[model samples]
Target: MGKLLENHSKNLLREAGVLVPKHVVARSPEEAAEKAAELGFPVVLKALVPVGKRGKAGAVKFAQNAQEAFELTRELLAMTVRHFPVEKVLIEEKIAIAQEWYLAITIDKKAQTPLIIASLKGGVDVEELSQSAPEQIMTKSIDPILGFAEFQAKELWSELGLTGKPLTLATQALTCLVKIFLAKDATLLEINPLVLTENGDVAAAASVMSVDDSAMYRHPELAAMVQLGSERTWRPLTDLEKRMVEVNELDPYRGTARYTEMDGGEIGFLCGGGGGSLLSFDALVSFGGRPANYSEVGGNPPERKVLGITKGILAKPGVKGLFVAHNITNNTQVDVLAQGVVQALKEMGKDPKIFPVVVREAGVNDEAAREIFTKTGVEYYGDNATITEAAQRMVERIKALEISGEGI
Candidate 1:
């Protein structure tokens, strides 16, 4: 998933002919004040972060004048909502809302189709509203092959008690929004408090959007706006994590390499595939091992990719040991994986003897893998040793090092 900040999402919505409040992005308190003065008074100030629920986090505020805007922007800039530091403020002219509505488009994974959700009530939590007053909300599923039509959008709003001009304008807005959602290959496009102005005009007051990262190749223009690989993390990517992204992207199509640094740990973890990585992590933790990072190396990756990710895993501060494991594989070459792991250890001067490296790789070319690992004094295990047993061995080695006063 690639989540776009509010400013970027609003820009896309505006370009699609949707009515949105005039907005400007300000990097500093002074800039915010200046923009607020220029755009006229009574503006909304929101921290420009990819995560949601900014209002609940106190990252959203209102200002009636330049002085208020400056002070409020300063406060917003000092906030870290959901672990993401606020670096920019989105300042927009506050619309006079007569009514607040909600609208959202997303994929229903179980059904494997596009889903549209709308409600006459807005400016409140949609989940809470659904539980309290389910009758007010409407949901429609669109066929991927057939697509959504303007008539469908009209019927949706009309059922929610919209009539006359508001009904027509709301229909048009929904139609445009659906088009943008499908064209951009978005996973989610949400408009909370889709407002009806005091003057009886329909407009989108706020938006949150995320596009599918796998479909990114078709949308080069969005490359700069979307924060790729953000879905896997709650906080902003650490410097080491960013380096790993570059490594994985080096050979995007050949295989998959993923790395995520943990808060603090002593063991550097390198596992294969998603399911295997999770099971290995759980097994290690269950055996009193603290892994410094979570990583997956699989899909017959080249030695270079493996080497790059392994180096990153070990480079994290406080990583004193390494643990490598994989399930029985039919495609991934264990010999090639061994070459990368051994090379990375040599490059980092991490001796398996004192540093505690354990390997439990099996299948394709396991015989060659075993020879390579054992040559480096690594505790190598083939299919005979289960992942759980390998994890227990790794923890035991770390314990032995601690007892001997020869810790890495």
Candidate 2:
């Protein structure tokens, strides 16, 4: 899933014949003021980040005039919402709301079909609505093969106490939304506070959308809007994380290498397999060791791919030691992994003896791996040491260096 910025999601809704507020992107406070002026008085300004809950974070503000817009935009720009910086602001015309509603379409993976969830009680968290007034919410599952019908949408809104023109317009908007969801391969399409204006017109005041990355080849126009690999992280990608993404893309077909940097730690972490990586990380933490980054490299990756990820792990600011561990493998060549680690350490001018590099790899050509690692002065373990034991050794090695006053 690649989450689109709010400006992009609203544009999608607008193109689908669903009414959306006129909006523009402004990168600076001055630009925001200009955009607010163009959109007319009482404009809304929202941070252009991919995360949610902007209003709670003070990333959403209102401006009665251009001066207010400039100051508010400056405040939003200086703040970081949910770890994502507000590099740009979305300026839109404020709508006169008579009532608020919610509509969201997403897949129910267990049922393997599309699920529609809507509520008349909007402008509040859906979880709160579910807890406070369960009956106010309505849910319907649509058949993937047959598709959702307009009559079904109409019936849904009509049952929720909508009888007049607002009901009819909402039905049409929902029908269009479902069509857009299927056509665009969207994983989630949500319009919170889907407003019924004072003029008795239905419009999407805000939207949140994400599309399937696997199906991205079909939608070239969304390439600029969607941030790849964003679903894996909660916030914006760090510079090192972006570099790792590029490294993985360099050899897309051969193997996999994924990396994520932690907030602050001293030991570098590298492991093979998802389950093994989690296990290793837990083991490290349980033994009073802090890992600087998390990485998974497997599927018999070539040496260069392994090399790239290893170098990235070691390049973090506070990383003082290296820990490499993997589960017993059938296809992955331990010797090849050993070579990559050795080359990375050499190129980075790191001495394994003083750097506290520990390895616990076992399987396929273990003898060659042991020789390679031992020759380079790395503490290597084959089947003799458990993953837990390897982690403890890594922690002890770092402690020893610190006590000896030879810390790197």
Predicted candidate 2 versus true structure: per-residue lDDT over 1-408, tens digit per residue = 678999999988898899999999999989999888988989999999987778887789899999999999999899888888789999999999999999999999899888999988878888888998999999999888999999999999999988889889999999999999999999899899899999989999989898886576679899899966555566777899889877776556677788888889999999987788899999999999989988988888889988999999989988889999997977789999999999999998899978989999999888999999999999999888899999999999878887888858
Global lDDT of model 2: 0.89
Tell me the TM-score of model 1: 0.93
Q: Which regions in candidate 2 have their CA more than 4 angstroms from the true location?
A: 106-115, 140-168, 179-187, 211-220, 227-233, 298-300, 329-336, 362-375
TM-score of 2: 0.85
Q: State in Å the error of residue 309, model 1.
A: 1.0
lDDT of 1 by residue, 1-408 (tens): 779998899999999999999999999999999999999889999999998888998889999999999999999999888888899999999989999999999999899888999998998889999899999999999878989999999999999999999999999999999999999999999999899999999999999999987677789899999876545676788899889878887666777788888889999999986788899999999999999988988788899999999999989988889999998877899999999999999999998877889999999999999999999999999989999999999999888877888757
Whole-model lDDT per candidate: 0.91, 0.89
**Estimated TM-score per prediction?**
0.93, 0.85
Candidate 1 ranges beyond 4 A from true positions:
228-230
